[model samples]
Target chain A: MNNIKELLKEQIKFTDGYLDKYLAEKDNPQNIIYKAMRYSVFAGGKRLRPILMMNTCKMCGGDVNEVIPFACALEMIHTYSLIHDDLPAMDNDDLRRGMPTSHIKFGEATAILAGDALLNKAFEVVSQYNGNNPQRAIKAMNMLAVSSGTEGMIGGQIVDMESEGKDITLDELKYLHLNKTGAIIRSACTVGALMGGASDGEIKAVDEFAQNLGVAFQIQDDILDVTGDEKELGKPIGSDAEENKNTYVKLVGLEKSKELAKEYSEKAKKSLEMFGEKAEFLINLTDYLIDRKF
Target chain B: MNNIKELLKEQIKFTDGYLDKYLAEKDNPQNIIYKAMRYSVFAGGKRLRPILMMNTCKMCGGDVNEVIPFACALEMIHTYSLIHDDLPAMDNDDLRRGMPTSHIKFGEATAILAGDALLNKAFEVVSQYNGNNPQRAIKAMNMLAVSSGTEGMIGGQIVDMESEGKDITLDELKYLHLNKTGAIIRSACTVGALMGGASDGEIKAVDEFAQNLGVAFQIQDDILDVTGDEKELGKPIGSDAEENKNTYVKLVGLEKSKELAKEYSEKAKKSLEMFGEKAEFLINLTDYLIDRKF
Candidate 1:
């Protein structure tokens, strides 16, 4: 466990360095957008998505350098989504990661443009990839686009928005999380696998692992919302209940949500069995996720 | 002039057909987003960008089929920009092209998501390009991303947003319009030339033509906003004045703005001299843009 923690710390540091390089600020009139983008990107994210991608690539015996650009691009997409999600028109979140949201810090218009710029930058970065295998880079780019697009994250977001304050079935909740969080998480692993030259079966296995892990991660988030330290979580608890959101903890009791999270976590780990000792870190990461307090 | 108009009409039809096919709606719960995207896309505006792209490809002796996907994607990017520009937090416009804006038709959240989905769809469509020239396609894709990103459209938008209601200088207004309206227009031409397999010299000529034409088009827009008929323009005139926007007309008097538009139009045509008679269509198109009532 301690070894995994140390590895995660190092991975986060490495990912952040790449992110900073790719998203470096410019000295121009429109630098405000750059500042706004870097603000949200560097706002102390756990860098889970990029870390997952890099590790997946390494585990598949792929060159980390080839995967680095896509990993950073994925993180940028994730950051852009969060920035847009916290807009006044959407979630209206004022505080994220213990800091004022992008819109709150920089007026609504700049924040929106910053989100847009980041999304555009993601593709820009991927398109600039001059790897030996251009086809694989193109494939990874498409996966990132499709997963973050209407049929994936946006679809989940719309459903989640519509289902607010309504009684949604468990199936509906599952669909929501699967698209919203699951799609991007799945894309991270699959894109990394593709970059690493994984076969179809290996890609499928990683997809399954990511899908289950995404759901478990969301379930843990819901459970933490109900019973989490405000200081550790960096936001007030019960906000989900306050918003009347249809979270896992809301549909099921807290104890049941925890049990389901563990079940999904176990399933996630089970999907990685084919990788054997090579996937030990991912397996441990799954355990850490379900057991995380923050 | 009539021949040019006929060609424009046919090009718009062809482009719209491809766009409809690419953005076809699925019978699913999240189909609302598709509907919203199609709504704004099919809205009755001149498909100038796509038309320019297809024509540029044809003039360069490249296959129009290869450029069709990119043409559609460029239009999608343009549409998404309009959707975002009309948001309540931004321009707050209620009507566009004589119809309710996306945010007015659909709610704010859906409008934002629809914009995002369209942007993602642009990249998704481009990534699916299976032309023989994968390198050229990648180059075009990168051009699209950079031109529409912070260094291009978004950069222009931020500067425009910041300069609102401020007494800005002529150079500032030019910079704003160049980045805002100019980047995407220039991208349309340059990407087409690249995909059409134009030589570097030809691409350079097209870039210069587009840079001048973009400014001419924007200047003409400013002039129409003050002097043209509202029914012909499809929206109320004087909105720029009402918003205190730093338009070319506002910075330079109306007559000088018109002169500037004509001067830029002439320069645009001048740059196309290398193609001689083959560039007649684009030259006429330039005249049409500057002389447009809308």
Candidate 2:
């Protein structure tokens, strides 16, 4: 814990190895989509969701290896969502994490298919989980599926699309972010809780913790879009405003948005009071998430 | 049974009822994607995949009702694939089943989200199957996920995209169809067998039956594209040629393609000899599939 950055780096490296195992290079006839999918998945991210899941499971006294496949699946789903969000029909972003977007590298059609394949493969990987608790594995898979489906991520996406360039209520904006980003993040925690065999009370506590953290994470993102350096952020700032998308920073002034993020982060940290010192990593992670320069 | 057409109609009706039950209209915030999903699913192209699943389950002495949720999930996945395939960057077809394509009916972004939602929801539905055999349900769900994933349908699709306007060999064409159209259709049967508590041997036989039927089904589609009437087919005739796609008809002459379909159909029927008269409906369905004018 002396060097949180080093700890995060180690977690990412471990997750990358697991992901590489799941997405090994193939030379089959249909290797094009696999290659494209592997490209986006291996395109570096913080692996925040998966690291959180594995850490939460470990904190709950569950064997981390049992949840490794599921953690990898979560990362794949996140990567696929990013790939789809960058499509020409969606946000149409050309760059992600300082690299060409999936549609920018592969053609749009192949990119779309690659995203589809990754999403399908996420479920395939989770369904193959041979952990000691089959029931909990199914439950974790179910939570992940619902969190990323129409009622969750996709639902939020459609609303975001419909609300683009149009004025939306603060509640509407919150609803959009809650589904588009919050649901999957929340699912990451809940699935980990289930896999870790957490007590019902602990599971509920983690859910609340994850939900608040997820919303706070998005608010920090909004803040970063205004204050983040392009070199560090790896993408242009002010694109959200340019796109006329409603965000916390746009709805409230920067100062008020920062205050809101702090409040949510505090609430996220407070939700872990049930775990005492065992929640140190999660509590520190929330602060780092909010205070990061990028 | 008398009138295989009537039997097919009854099966479609049953599957439709089950689908409607699963896809109940919701007034939630993300209702837009749900509406788009329901529209494509109900657009109707003969509930062939779901029917094959249900029939396969019944033929193996399993209760059809036990696999209803999964059968509906199969249709949802099939409908989602069609929606994505009809996008502007893909086949760019405006009409499917005589109705405007999903992206035409809904905007492109919403259509894409709708397809993503459907795919996710398919897994959610199957994962919620509280049937008598939880282990089998997980296995069936895994099979469906894998079958429609990069190694299966999407794999076929990427190759199909790359092969466009290129002169591909007959073997290449078969590989594409075996994945693109063949995988899910085959999954419908394999999943059914797994759910129906079939023996390993029985499941293998049904898998072989489905593989043959899926290929034959695609060959019939090729034949229909070249020789069938648009009024009966719903979609335009010669559209495959219009797209410069390599099809069975394009590689082999129409007569040869038709003969190949017949050969596969006979093989499909022969594979079902293991089930004796219990597979009557499936056997008749194979003939109907090959002999279908629409």
Candidate 1 lDDT, B1-294, residue by residue in tens: 888889898989999899999999988778898999999999985989998898888778888899988899888999999999999999998989889999999999999999999999999999997667677788899999999999999999999888787898888888998888899899999988888888999999999999999999999999999999989988788988987878888888999999999999999999999988889899999998888887
Q: Residue by residue across A172-290, what tens digits does model 1's lDDT show?
A: 99999999889999999999889988889999999999999999999999999989999999999999999888999989899999899999999999998888898988888989888
The runs of at least 3 residues in candidate 1 whose Cα sits more than 4 Å from the true structure, single-residue gaps closed, are none
RMSD of each: 1.1, 1.4
What lDDT score belongs to each candidate, Candidate 1 first? Answer: 0.90, 0.88
DockQ of predictions, in order shown: 0.81, 0.80
* Candidate 1 clash pair list: none
* B192: Cα error in model 1, Å: 0.2
**Winning candidate number (lDDT):** 1
The Cα error of candidate 2 at residue A33, in Å, is 1.3
For residue A277, give model 1's deviation from the true position in Å: 1.8
Q: State the lDDT of candidate 2 residue by residue for B40-134, as single tens digits.
A: 99987688888999989988888998988889998889988999999999988888887899999988988888888888889888887665567
Evaluated on the second chain alone, the candidates' TM-scores are 0.98, 0.97
Q: State the weakest 10-residue window (summed lDDT) of model 2 chain A.
A: A129-138
- Which residue runs of candidate 2 sit more than 4 Å off their true CA positions? none
